[model samples]
Target: MNTNDLKIFEAVVESGSFTKAADIMFTVQSNVTARIKSLEEEFNAKLFSRTSRKVELTEEGKILMNYAKQIQHLVEEAKNEIISNETVNGHLTIGCMETTMTLKAPEILLAFGEKYPAVELEFKSDNRDSLISAVLNYKLDAAFVSGPLNISGLEKIKIKEEQLVILASSKEAGLNKLLAKEPMKSIVFDNGCIFRERLESWFSHKGIHNYKSIELNSIEGIINFVDAGLGISLLPEEVVSRYYQGRNICTYSLNKQLGTMTTLLVYRKGKAPSTALQSFIDMHIEDIA
Candidate 1:
């Protein structure tokens, strides 16, 4: 029930280790354990299932974790909002898609941090769906995500519009000829990926059905697999060109209807951003998380 207990709980959940969470808080492991025990006693529910390797959340723990995260974020938001605008402070947690994190977020973080030196910033990166879910649940103050976002109760500010491109190996035939040769196999992220739906739509449009798809978690893996002639994938032109530079990969532009995606800075619709978060949006640099 206490904010401090929830904060400690959040740290433990994030670290997955009482000792490490204690280290982060500059406290002893026993103190961390005591705080967790206090929380469990106060709520009359077990929060974590402990094992030798790591602590896992129980069903009740998972439910409480959501509320704990939302409370922790709100506490931070309130602290930041109550501070003088002339001097911004408090922690800001933002979510971002992997593409934006890699290609755009660095400069934005640097500039924002320089402007509000007292503010602490933490970023979590994942697929668009995950980012959206985190933001919706108040796990993040805001996030940089790609569309199409159909979720409710979100306000989006379009930051970047990227054209999706298909990368083809230089040794292989062009897109048409390549598709003709085999049932398409793509190296992509799992179902919640930003580009998965678009990529599937593109295939369906081309009358290519029942193709083989493989999931990969790394940007390098996706690009390398395609470059090695494993399969084709749809990705942001700007990102692929930047990361896969000096390679023998050639980009094939898709139809405008299928190839364009927009990166958005989305937050809850009714809530106002903290000064620290506002600075990030106002900086409005061309790219990054």
Candidate 2:
């Protein structure tokens, strides 16, 4: 019905829950529901299929999402062009892998905020695939993802490379005991994580299949699980050093190709960069190298 309605609709579909949409949009859940209802009434069509646990867009909603995104983009571009941002003033949503958030991102995040205090920066912590998907959907201005990323529809600038390391508990038995342990559990992030893929490949290449995986949603939990002798995990050496320095952990180096991975700052290739995003990339992308 209106721009605000479209914005709310887009947020709901993207967030997939009224509660999350309300938080992202900075409003109440009832208000989000009301606005969406108003939109559906105005358009005389149901936009979302709502259930107890999930909110998904109906077919009509999908078509409207494309238009809503375009409208939002144009509105954002217009605002950026019309405003004089001699000191950049806009919102930038950046998605990142949780691992990068813990180790590599703090200094850059702090510096960026201090330098451009007026720009509103929101950071989302997610796994690699979700981060890339968010960027493609225009939910984020950019994302920090680990690579040898060869994904289409993205432009990636390598910022840093770190060696992936195998971690085991210092007090726990080494390989022999590890291999013989009843359920050789792998501590890992949820399925879409690249590091998990690497760990799986490493096991298969070594003819060690049938290992059970303990899927965790956060890096700290995974590290703690591994450190407590529950299972082993794969993580970047930089991350392990930064967080577990001087802790009771043993690190094993991997083969070159399997060990090294690049951290890339990526954005949608054909999408026009807004002033906020462009300034961000120019400041960090070039500054890093």
Candidate 3:
């Protein structure tokens, strides 16, 4: 019914709980529930299917969510435009893959921090699919993701290309020797990771369909596991070189077909980026170019 009501709705949709949305909105659960109920009544539809554990958006809720995001975006754009002549101070939430967080984010963070100290910067490390979803939902101002992207409603800029490699313990001399280990394990990120998907494809290409997967969430954890000979992993060469340079690890290049992936900086296509976000994008472009 109003922007405040829509804000509560978005929060509930994102957090998937009226209680959690209350926590985010700095209100109580009853208020969140009342606002959602009011919105549903106004629209003459049930917006969410509630359960004891969580809430799931209904079909009508999905439609409203799309328009709610647009409204929120427009509201922010208006605020940004009104303050265009003022100091460059705003919040930016950026998302990226864990590998990029390790290899690329530090320099960008350092430079951006020094230049725009007034802006608040928050970074989230997630897999490609999660990052894409966050960007699409207005949760992230921008994201750095692995690409050859073709998603609608998003704009992308190729920032860098990383060569993918098979990382193994230094005890293994080569890829074949590493593959010979019985019950070969793969140390990888959780599902929805682009690198993990590529690793699976590589295994399938080699007629390997039954290897065990050791899912770890952090880049350091994956590298440490690989170094300990617990398993092998597919990761960026730059990431391995940077984090495990002198450790007991070796990397073998993948064939060209599966070897390279581009890192793209992506944002919503039609939305005008906030001052802080636009400044960060400019700095990223200059840094990478």
Candidate 4:
């Protein structure tokens, strides 16, 4: 119906609870319920199937959600386009892989902040897959992820190439000795991580399929586990060198095929970037190129 109705609907869908949506909208539960009821009545369709715990979107609601998101994005884009260049102030949410956040984000973000102090920036760290999903869903304006992306509705700019390396404890003399270790445990981020996928591929290439993995969410945790001789891991060389750099850790380079990965700044295709996002892209493109 109205933009306010769509906003409330989006909030309820995102939070999955009427009370939670009300809290997000800074309104009461009754107001949220009334808005949803009005929308359902107006459309003559059941929007959400409700349970005591939460609500699930119905078929009609799913279709409406797609349109609602596009409308919201277009509204925001129009506002950004009409605003004067001298006042480029808005929220910019970016998603990033953990390793990229560690090695590349700080300096760039610092400089961007200095230049555009009024623009709010929020950086969320996650695995490549999750970050991509967030960007597709319009939860992130853009993301820093590994390159060679072939997904539809996404555009990417190459930021830099990073050499991937195998990390082990110093107690291991060489790659051969490390591979010969019993159980062949690996320290890695969870399933959706690009590095973890590469680690698995490397193991498969070497005809080793029985290795065990210790999944962690933190880059520091994986590095510490590798340093403790608990397991080996595959990560960008810069990440290991910059973050750990401990005497207990040893780095082994992958063969050229597995060694190289490009970090890319990815955003939705066909959408004009917000002024703040455009500024970030312009600032980095030359430096990275």
**Global lDDT scores for all candidate models:** 0.82, 0.84, 0.87, 0.88
Which segments of model 3 are wrong by more than 4 Å?
A: 11-34, 37-56
What is the TM-score of each predicted model, taking all chains together?
0.76, 0.81, 0.88, 0.92
* Number of colliding residue pairs in each model: 3, 0, 0, 0
Q: Which model scores highest in TM-score? A: 4
For candidate 3, give the lDDT.
0.87
C-alpha-based local distance difference test score of model 4: 0.88
Per-residue lDDT of candidate 1, residues 166-258 (tens digit): 777777868788888667887788888877778898889989996899898877888888888888888899976777877768888889888
Residue 94's lDDT within candidate 3 is: 94
Q: Mind giving the per-residue lDDT tens digits that candidate 3 earns over 1-289? A: 7899999999998899888899999999999989999998999999999888999999999999999988887788677657756778777889999888888778877878899877778889998888999999888989999888999989888898889998889976777976776677899999999888999999999888779999998988998899888999999898867667898998888998899998899999875677778898888788778
Note each model's CA RMSD in angstroms.
Answer: 4.4, 4.1, 2.6, 1.9
Q: Return the lDDT, model 1, position 134.
A: 84
In candidate 3 the C-alpha lDDT for residue 171 amounts to: 75
Ranked by TM-score from best down, the candidates are: 4, 3, 2, 1
As for lDDT, the candidate ahead, 2 or 3, is 3
Q: Which pairs of residues clash in candidate 4, taking residues 3 or more apart in a chain or in different chains?
A: none
